[model samples]
Target: MNVSTATVSLALRDSPLVAEQTRERIKDHARAIGYIYNRRAASLRTSRSGIVGVVVHDIMNPFFAEILKAIESELDRSRQTFILSNHYDQLEKQRTFIDTLLQLGADGVIMSPAIGTPPEDIIVAEENGLPAVLIARTVEGAQVPVFRGDDAYGTALATNHLISLGHKRIAMVGGTDQTSTGRDRYHGYLGAMEKAGLPVDPAWRISGPRTKQGGFEAAGQFLALKDKPTAACCWNDLVAIGLMNGISRAGLVPGVDVSVTGYDDLEEAAIATPALTTVWNGQREVGRQAARALLDKLSGASVKPSQELIRPELHVRQSTARPVERS
Candidate 1:
């Protein structure tokens, strides 16, 4: 009660300048008196909104949800507020979100950049004082700290696992070539096929599906291929699960009649109709590291612009098996 006006102000705002005991005492007294601190006023005074932005492809997707959970946990420890957005691979939507963050003076952003996101977009955000960290996907010329799983390595693990099960005619289902992630995953599948001395038919690469519905819809096309693939290496678990469901709809037993492999061992993969064989893409680690890198940048630490790739592991399950002849 005898503290200077400045000390009272700092105490109400939870600033460390106030002693812990005094700060708690002041807070308790304020609560007793029904005093509410004005966060907006505090933000204006300190020039820090305490807000960080996280934009990803889709929040509903379990893959991104896992990453976001990790990010939220890390940011919670720092007592930083975060704003989340889904660009849905739309460049314009992503740009709009970045602009909004800049206008609101957000401290930083962690993004799994939208498809075709130019490097300049990332540069512009940084130049305007919003430091950037990339996750999941990469913009070729963006010089920012990036945290993601080794896509090529992860998909390669899935492909190789299917190959090990004696699947020679393997198809890569889901994902497009528009984003770096798509390209890396496809290349991983391709490389694994080549390395295994398996002939890759052009039709085996089914691009343009990154969702469960997309995968489900693509099932007919997949099944209709003249040279039927004995196994499918899906873009992610969602797609693999969807494809498996479609396989069942078509009266074929997945894992028995047709084997399927998925990337990103999301939580649902294990409980899928036939437990999915998948690659552990380290989504949580990527999210945690990306959030930490951005927080470091906000704390005035020098974060070098580099690609940090978390190594991936393969988890074998019921959805994959040796090739069975299909009439």
Candidate 2:
């Protein structure tokens, strides 16, 4: 009770300089007295808000949701508060979030950058003292640590699986080439097709669909193809599930009439009517590693600016099988 004011202050801040027992005693007494610690005042004094920012394309997307869960767990373990933003691939929205984080004096950021995000945006953020770690996407020349699955390799695995099922005519549905992820996935599909000596018709690469609705709408166009493909390799699990539903609505059995493969083995993929054959893209690993990298940067540890690609595994399920030729 007679501890110095300096000791009480340090104990209230949970500073390591204060003995743990003393800190606990002080916190208990403060709570008993209804004394609320002003975090704003503490941050002004220590120049650390204990806050981190995370911005991604879409929080509603299960892929990002999985990643966020890991990030939240890791940050919580370190006693950090995190702010999340969904840019929806809008560069302006991403920039606004970054700017807000900076204004709020956030300790660091972990972002799965928006499509069309220029390297300068990252550079400026770093220059302004907002250390950032990237996940699920890359910005060239950003000179920051990036954590993501090997998109090219992951999609290649899906394409090769379809090839193994003897699908000579395969369609790649969903996704656009506006971001590194999109380009990598498309190239992966293209490369795998070429490696298998399978012809990739120009019409087989259906772009601009990254959601369930998009995939559902694309089904009619896909079904109407003069030389309809026997299989579709979708950009993600959501698209694959949607496409499978569309196939069902059209009275075609998805696994039988048209084999489908998906990327990102989201939880829902395993429960779909014909359980989806998908690529495990390591979303949680991406989130956890990215959070650690940023925390390391915040702690004044040297984190190399490099890309860490988590290897993906293929999960075979009911959705893909030997193709059934249709009239």
Best by TM-score: 2
- Cα lDDT tens digits for candidate 1, 130-230: 99999988899999998999999989989999888888999999998887888999999999999999899999888877778988988898999987998
Q: Mind giving the per-residue lDDT tens digits that candidate 2 earns over 112-215?
A: 88988999999999999899999988999899999999999999999999999899999999998988899999999999999999888999989988888888
List the pairs of residues colliding in candidate 1: none
- Our tally of clashes for model 1 stands at 0
Q: How far in Å is the alpha carbon of 256 misplaced in model 1?
A: 1.0
Q: Could you tell me how far off, in angstroms, the CA of residue 271 lies in candidate 1 after the best superposition? A: 1.0
* Each model's lDDT: 0.91, 0.92
Candidate 2 yields a Cα-based lDDT of: 0.92
RMSD of each: 2.1, 1.8
Clashing pairs for predicted structure model 2, backbone only: none
